[model samples]
Target: MAASEKQVVVVGVDESDYGVHALEWTIDHLFAPSMPDYPFKLIVVHARPSAASTAGLVGPGAAEVFPIVDADLKRSAARLVQKAKDLCASKSVHDVTIEVVEGDARNVLCDAVQKHNASILVVGSHGYGAIKRAVLGSVSDYCAHHAHCTVMIVKKPKAKH
Candidate 1:
């Protein structure tokens, strides 16, 4: 691809409502009527957490159980990416590409941006408390600063009290 031929808009997705919101926001705001002038590919990315995390949680004898857990995780990730693809198709955004990668969410997403030659990366914020965010490290926060492309962090709607 040429230096001026940047294509593909990469969106980080998952099974959460926040992920859905990010996809919807992309369709509603960026690709709604479709821009012929700025035609681009839509690459929906979902980062599956490493199986080691679960293996560690299940204790020492986890080797026997890790395969089952890993399989389930793969199935769940496939379902999530498929749902995101279907949602985009329903919004008239067909020809979407789905990528299910494994690793830390931040690294996976940033890597996707570079791999896809995307100019923009969209992700949703989970709105965790400050302490939780500090401890866990927000994916959106990491992507905003680390991604090679421009980043859009969508916020999920607040529930009515």
Candidate 2:
């Protein structure tokens, strides 16, 4: 089947283990080789925060710091994409696209869904408390309401003491 004919499944990932676990869950449950002729195309997306947004500072030395911070962010993004690719490869999922988009996670993910014409948008929940989620503005929550497709928020299981 042509690429365009396949239903797109966009998975939003980050450096967090929660995001990684979500990807794993999506693969294991939806993209398993055991499934007969899975017609969905997998696209892994990483939203990379810009240096200025992450630096959280504006001062005399800010200009000088931007380059270094930007480089670090680029490296981090590369690693994140590689990790996602590696995970997919380990699962025998070779026909996958990995993207690193520079923006807030919520916006990037939603845009990716539109750009890819995705049928499903998968995100990992941080499982924050009400106060923390309110303060930080949960990306999963935002995407769940704003994304144009079905959104799946995967929550990682907590470890037992």
Candidate 3:
């Protein structure tokens, strides 16, 4: 199939192990070279929190602090994207595209699906409890409901004790 004719699969990733595991699982399952023809294009997306949002502060030397915080956020985003790229490379999935969008993960991922006309959106579950999920707002849950395409929430298997 031509490049543009391939279906797009967008995976949201973070620094968490769950996110890494999801990407790995997606690669192993969906992008396996053994498949006759690769019909899916992989897009790895990282949602970066803006420095102002992360800082959650204003006034009183906030101006001086903003630039420093922004720089740190940029570095963190670079590291996260690099890690995702390295993982894809290690899996022999080099045709993947990586994006760093500054916003909430849920919105960024949903927008990515629309922007890329994705057929599937995959995200890792943090496995938070109900109360925690309520407080923190689950990105996978939100994407599952709001994204136009199919959504897959990859959960890390519980470790054997």
Please report, in order, the local distance difference test score of every candidate based on alpha carbons: 0.86, 0.93, 0.92
Provide the global lDDT of candidate 2 against the true structure. 0.93
For candidate 3, the lDDT comes to 0.92
Question: Which stretches of model 1 miss by more than 4 angstroms?
Answer: 1-6, 34-38, 57-60
Model 3 lDDT per residue over 1-161, tens place: 55659899999999899998999999999989698467799999999998899998878998888899999999988998889889888878888899999999989999999999999999999999999999998999999999999999999999999
TM-score of each: 0.89, 0.95, 0.95
Which lDDT value does model 1 have at 65? 78
What's the best-to-worst order under lDDT? 2, 3, 1
3-108 per-residue lDDT for model 2 (tens digits): 5588999999999999999999999989888875678889999999999999987889999998899999999999988899899989988889999989999999
lDDT of 1 by residue, 1-161 (tens): 76656478999998899998998998878786656444567888999987787566655777877788799999999789778878887878776888898888889999998898789999999999999999989999999999998999999989999
Kindly report which residue stretches of model 3 are placed more than 4 angstroms away from their true locations once superposed.
1-4
Give the higher-lDDT candidate: 1 or 2. 2
TM-score of 1: 0.89
RMSD of 1: 2.3
Candidate 3, residue 159: Cα displacement in angstroms equals 1.6
